[model samples]
Target: MLTYFRQRYPTRIEIDEDGNTVEVPLSDPMLEAKLHIALSTDGRHWFPLNANEPVWDQWMRDPYVRRGPDGVWRILTTGTTDGYNRDASGPGCFFASSKDLIHWNDERTLPLMEEVRDASGNFLANNIWAPEWFYDEENEEYILIWSSSFKDAGWKESRLWYSKTKDWKNFTPAKVFFEPPYSVIDGTLLKHENAYYLFHKEEEFGAKTGERRAIRLATSKKLEGPYQIVDGDLNDGQIVPVITEGPTIIEDPENSGWLLYYDYCMTNRYGASFSKDFLNWEILDDVHFPADARHGCVSKISSEEARTLINEYNISSSTDK
Candidate 1:
């Protein structure tokens, strides 16, 4: 199942002072900033459920869905109370659980950043976004990672923060998970063999420094760690191009390699890269996604599960052949 957020922009046409009509984009209070689920036989083409309406009607974005060890599906999203008033600062993200993909419950804010503090007991996080779940089979615990900016840094720089939790109800104090010299966000983890590969976005766009807004990689021997940046001939350490974010990696269904999908925000299109090893990647062509699909994660679903969601949402005709 492919889970994403559908962004809606309502516009109104008005006569300007120069007597010419112009279409002005208006803000949506809801922002249509809710979770939408879709089904795809192949990862390229997607058919939206609920007639392209949001499956979960909540003001959240960047939905990451994963089934826990208990066989229950859980989703974590960037949470905000008022969609219009949202900024680069927030208290925490939101969480929801589901037995089946059709019905979700236990929706509430995680309040993760409330526990993040500096040595002087000062809470420095101004914004929290893109919380991802990684189950550490070695440690038998779950790690929740997200990005945050600091009050001390004037919220200009961001880094990945993480916490350990055995149960979803309780979490250890948040600590810096990965902090490079530059700002980073939207981290997704892939564990291969004994190493963990973190694919994330470098948020810097300094023209003089030639820093492009693109996705880069870092790997570590441990889950929470001193991750070293993988820099070499792999596009000079950047796998994807500029203006790409919200990366979700999944294994190729054909068992040939791995597929990494990211949101090309500037072009409103989804881009993909193919990789066998974590170090090298090839940008793929001929990938297609649902119109207006924004930042979200992709998970493989069984044939029965796909049929269940399609029947429940009554979107049989929407599926692409």
Candidate 2:
């Protein structure tokens, strides 16, 4: 914890609102501990919602945002106390809930990997990464999912696991959610029409030649899925040569289409593509993201909510703050 005060981590605001993906560069972590808020009516250009105000103080990875049934805005992210990425030896997942994204107070932690064990009493996974949850409207529960690797298996064997929760206080024991033939991480889900679309980063060697870390798609009819990967070109002919990870899916509120946001980590760039139907994609250009932004989720809020957030967090009206 002392390291936090001594060293500031690189953080960025990466969000997908409506159809456009916007990434904002935060000046410093200590100043924006709660996290700076920004809003985009057009989605392409973003305006700051708060001026150097902290939205959240805790460290998070692959942070996901969603509104809960109780009308609280909840963020479920991979929680870590030490080390970079998801290698820390603390809570497997961290959760925080807020009526406004600015004043988050409700908090909870789950030692999922430590608690859930195999028949041999060995922990199934230790390095938990990218935890996310969405409301299962039909079932009336929130289905939480994340990626983790088993102790017996190596990190390359990382796969997704899920649990159910209602009040965000207690959760059902973790269970395997999706297991592709190869190692995978950074799993995200978006429901369209009646089917659920899952986007994940898979580790595999390209069929013809070299090592490949690519974004792949899978689909299922039910929320608790036996998701099948959509077979085709992994990058859809875009982002060739450079690999990508951390795929986020969101509905295009403006066009009714969908947007896929991913990370080009090697280049430290955020990428996006649009699709009316999930099958076809047109890689989008002109999308700008903060250099430090890595894996984070986006969500849409009402205009009133946005204004309230700005006022509440004291985001300066003038851009130059």
Candidate 3:
């Protein structure tokens, strides 16, 4: 079974001055964009796991779910608290673990940015975004990678940073993971045949820069890298649309190649591309996803586990395909 964990934006209906009913977005959409679940037998059709309600309702975004070697599922999300520094910047990302995917526990902040500092020994990051976990088989540890923007640059130049941990409780000091010439964020890794591919969003725009806000690729031999960008048609080697972000890739369930999916933010929909070599890609036009799903990762789950979640959440077959 295929499982998708994502952020959902809900709305409320209200009457206007003309007595017309209008769908109004939540008062604080970002805070309300909580974690939701969807399940699929095939990659093409999806069913909401909890009647379209958020499975983990909290102020979080960009939920990445991965099951560890210990048989526990863990989630790292873009979250924050009011107790940290009393500013707009998030002290760190949010974390939670579960033996089963339905009920989560041990929810807390990782405080990752606290360990990141400048030459003056002061914390430099103003925000932490899109934390993802990659397990290194050779090193026998998990590497947590995320994007951060420095205070010195007024949070303009976002780059990827990472830390290593065997247990989630303690992490190695945060350090620069990837610092390209241009601003980048939403970094996700794919390991194939002893090579590591990095898919990230180039967060630059405008006529002067001649850059686009789209997904780009970089590759390295080691998990942590001196990565070289793959040259392509778009500026800085982009592979997708001009207004896309939040890229996530999965092995095709019914095919040999891989499916790379991303959020078309400007159009409020999802798009996909397919690749077998990871060097050449074909944008797919007929793919489908659950309505309004945003910025999530896909993982395979056991059929028994999927059934349990479906029963617990009362997911109906009538949901959108």
Candidate 4:
């Protein structure tokens, strides 16, 4: 689909009702999701991941884009980008699927019948942060990882929850995968060899003069885990805090080295990193960065899916004026 933009002005017209002139201020949908100001019909292709046209009428944020086995690239993100106030307890993770990376269809009505909640019996709830999902080939299971809050808890106390299913139409109840006074937000998972590795960013307490957050890792012997922290570096390995977040790791099909992608908040640019081992990482500048005026952030890079879209499909490029 093509997009169009216009500079709109709210024209004031007085309407006489009974004996009074009533006026209304035309409403403008919030342009930015909590973090992402733009979106894409394709997997964040073109620039300004958001459309040139205003498609997101609700408050959508923390998008996790992935491709399912059926050749459908599914984007699961938080917020309605239109209707919900965030605390209203609506469908937090908005799911959208696309085939050519240009035209997208919201999958919210896909009959997702799975129900997973927090340990407190408070049902799957708020914040609706970065959401990542994968197809487990071995178990034929689909696992979704996202940052969510318990209905009764504080914001920084958000926990990472995982739901498993064999089909996208059905989901299992959310169970806490990670939690904290450490304030862990977005948890990204990858299946490599004999174990499952998870990378997450957490807000650290008071530190030196200019410290912000830390990116850490945890490993599990099984998908369902008693996970153990492997290593954590809040310093961005010297990249700085504002430049670090939305970490996603995937195996490079060209070699054994893994690639990591994330949005650099400080410079408002997205980049890639490489690691022979999941712990030691080095950022690379070869991958193209989306060029949105609002930081032009990329929510994630799913190598398995993005590769197919970029290489095989007839993807279209978009730019919003």
**Candidate 3 off by > 4 Å:** 1-31, 81-90, 118-121, 151-155, 234-236, 316-321
Across 35-145, the per-residue lDDT of candidate 3 in tens digits comes to 777777656666776766677667677788888888999888877532123143336888899998878899988878786666876667777788899989898899999
Number of residue pairs clashing in candidate 3, backbone atoms closer than 3 angstroms, sequence gap of 3 or more or interchain: 0
Instruction: For candidate 1, write residues 155-236 as lDDT tens digits.
Output: 1478899988988999998889999987898999989888888999887653343545678889999888789998835445
Following a full C-alpha superposition, what root-mean-square deviation does model 3 have from the true structure?
6.8
Q: Rate the local accuracy (lDDT) of all candidates.
A: 0.76, 0.63, 0.76, 0.53
Cα lDDT tens digits, model 2, 68-97, are: 778887777666643123323333677777
Sum up the clashes in candidate 4.
19
Predict model 2's lDDT versus the native.
0.63
TM-score of each: 0.85, 0.78, 0.85, 0.64
Candidates sorted on lDDT, descending: 1, 3, 2, 4
Q: What is the lDDT of candidate 3?
A: 0.76
Evaluate model 4: give its lDDT.
Answer: 0.53
TM-score: model 3 vs. ground truth: 0.85
Worst 10 residues of 2 by lDDT: 1-10
For lDDT, candidate 3 versus 4, the one ahead is 3
* Residue 261 alpha-carbon offset, candidate 3, angstroms: 1.3
